[model samples]
Target: MILEPFPPALPYDFVFKLARDSHDLEGYHKLRREIFCEEQHVFETDDRDLFDESAMPIVCKSLIAGMEDTVVGVVRIDERSSGLWYGSRLGVSSGFRRLRHISPGVAVRNLQPCYAALGALGAGLIYKAVSTACALGCHEFLATVQQQNARFFQRLHWQPLENIMLHGLPHVLMRADLNHYAAAKKVA
Candidate 1:
């Protein structure tokens, strides 16, 4: 059987920074609407909720020369209580959904192994949010993942604590294994 070759090691520079200004915040929301409301139809019109008021948004932008620093992916995190944090609204722009296919540039050659394994834009965004939670001293990180994507979270070292329903849809309550996500510390 012919084994598939490795993805090309090309330049993949993108800024995975927290939304600090209105522009960043707007971009984050726009990406979320595009993914959830339009693409996934998870929301009727807008996905903004009470959590958005307190959540800290993180965005991934293209770092390629001559290209705008477009928000390619976004995820938000919020502390629900003492030592507990939750990540939500993890989404990537439709056009950039192929983040897994993009290899890192030479500058990121020393990135952690987890980045290599979870190489997609959406995964990277989640890693960033989780890292931020860890840096903020969260004892446990949680998220309600869509049922279909539960296995994807498992691959990223998240354990399903329970199966539940949210907004009339099946979902899984998951917790991140800090050990498997240690790489997030470096970027946090």
Candidate 2:
């Protein structure tokens, strides 16, 4: 079913579920490599971490066309003792890239606008997950975002609770109050 992919434009149909076991791991890794490594100037190293094995992946299909449909977006959530959280490589594919303010003549930036739309998508999904986590007795939603991406979370009122420097790259430990997430859901 379509759950509002974006404000006025819906690019993909939302699928709130887990990644396929083992068999689909390669897809997730390749996506992370393309969006984070190839598209962005981020590190080319494999983005996998300990949580990858446990994190369940989520996909977005074209709402107009429908999984024979293209997989335009992907994300995975992993729980750390602190609270249930998800992170590491969430991005929109190049094909469905929206052309707007970021669709500058520059080839590389053409897709940034499409990815910008993902903020709305991620917020919708993650907040729902946070609500579920709260029901499961989680107190907060935790995530480690690349320091360069802190602005995205900040748009949703998330705060950087910790500063981390690892492997010569800056990262931030961000926390979202699930209490607020639940309250928002209740209001909705």
Model 2 scores a TM of: 0.63
- Steric clashes per prediction: 0, 1
lDDT of 2 at 171: 86
Candidate 1 lDDT by residue in tens digits, 2-87: 99999654336676778888888889888889988998898999999999899988888776673437788899999999989999
All models, RMSD in angstroms? 5.6, 10.2
User: Whole-model Cα lDDT per candidate?
Assistant: 0.78, 0.55
Residue 12, model 1: lDDT of 62
Clashes of 1: 0
TM-score of 1: 0.83
Error of 2 at 71 (Å): 2.2
Model 1 worst lDDT window (10 residues): 106-115
| Clashing residue pairs for model 1 | none
Model 2, residue 148: distance off in Å is 3.0
List model 2 lDDT by residue over 1-188, tens digit each.
Answer: 86955546544443333345553456556777788777775666666677766765655434344333345556666667765555546565665444233222211211111233545445544554455455456666777777977887776668889899855778898987553565222211
CA lDDT of 61 in candidate 2? 37
